[model samples]
Target: MSRRTASRALIAVALSVSLAACGSDDGADSPDSSPSAAATEVTTDLSEKPEVPASDDPAPDELVIDDVVVGDGAEAVTGSTADVKYVGAFYESGEEFDSSWSGGADETIPVPLGAGRVIPGFEQGIEGMKVGGRRMITIPSDLGYGPEGSPPVIPGDATLVFVMDLVEVTP
Candidate 1:
């Protein structure tokens, strides 16, 4: 079967598993798949942010990238073109849920970075990163699940986290 098909099937299974918590919301199940290595690995054209002055804390909520660790998260932002791979874990249990490229292969997926293709946290988080930079992004429940989470591993209103390594950028 095609990888995409397999992924869809996995999403369906994941939803069922999550049903234990989010309740059978019936038709609210989103076709959104868990983060793939590629999703986080968006090795996009790197445009390094100018050093924020030590006192430079824009919106206290805006997240900043430092050595791949996200801090002071700003509202989510989108990249222009990204090639990446990623690994996802549930915030509550810290259990790995998905990855774009398993075994850390040098695989890159080029995508038009935006909201629909990826989760809101992701589409908004990796903005202003350089092409070959690696960063870890922690997404809040609101940007992640809102209120009802996909059950089982991801509890209701669960937050999600991703350890991403922006491997390359297609420019």
Candidate 2:
């Protein structure tokens, strides 16, 4: 199977295990237990910078992309340039490392997809997203800065999390 397909399979298995662990044996009435529900519950407001919460579950070995809000605008593809506002943090600790919104909510940066400008996980995760959409991207270390890491802000072999808001897509 292709890498993407394999990665997706791994994600599904990991999420299934995680959900099973969160379930109660007595089957008591519980809150919405889906991964999307938990992720969406953190922040769904489009106007504000997304808030990425700390995860109790172990980091996945593959990429996980969860859309918090679906947009109704132009789509982003390999050749498209995406103007996005984002907040980046460590997956394990939810400690912020970088953000396009650091300057201001209106401050966004353009990312050239498939251009090798950004990390592999980030570029791949943002693909197929539409303008005005918000997504949570969980990236394994291999797809991020790797074993050496970016340093200062990112640690060695860190699993990164990014809450991204796609503002516009330039074809």
Candidate 3:
């Protein structure tokens, strides 16, 4: 084919592709597209309870964890990854809500230090700990579970105490 004819054919093909893309109704699989109006509902089994303002102090009757000793190490950034074994509890009644050691699990998970993956307090407190170290972070409700607290086991406005074991450094 002549150069002008070949160029025209290529241009026509490009225009066709553009038009087809613009006409597509499927937004789910499109990279730049948003979820369609028929988007599925987002739900979870565990629901958080509304929190109340808690005392700034760790409750007087809170149970004591003898083994954990708080420390200071690296200032953890949002995306920083750390090797940590953690046990969480309500700061009020001192109930064990969730833990990495639950069901006698010994393996430590690599926690991505960020906002969503972890409680805001745990994420903020664990920063600045060196490897082979531990920190007993006592987070007040505002810094912890917040207004929408993890309920039943973790009561609203409950202070949280975490014994964070920093096993290694992945950064």
Best by TM-score: 2
Cα-based TM-score, every candidate: 0.50, 0.78, 0.52
Candidate 3, residue 29: the lDDT equals 25
Flag clash pairs in model 2. none
lDDT per model vs. reference = 0.51, 0.84, 0.54
Output the better candidate (1/2) by TM-score.
2
Tens-digit lDDT track for model 3 on 17-98?
9998776563432222232111111111112111212224535332222223323456345577887776665554445666
Candidate 1 TM-score to native: 0.50
**lDDT tens string, model 1, 1-171?**
999999999999999888876753424322122333323443333332211111212222322233443223222225456665666675445467776655445655554567357667765555544455555565777777557776655666655666554544443
TM-score of 2: 0.78
As a TM-score, model 3 comes out at: 0.52
Minimal lDDT window, size 10, model 3 = 37-46
As for model 2, its CA RMSD to the true structure in angstroms is: 13.3
The residue-by-residue lDDT of candidate 2 on 1-171, one tens digit each, is: 999999999999999999988876633321122346437655878887777898889889988888787778998889999999999988877888899987998998899998999999998889878888788889999999999988677888999999899999998
Backbone clash pairs for candidate 3 read: 70-136, 73-128, 73-129, 74-128, 74-129, 91-159
lDDT of 2: 0.84
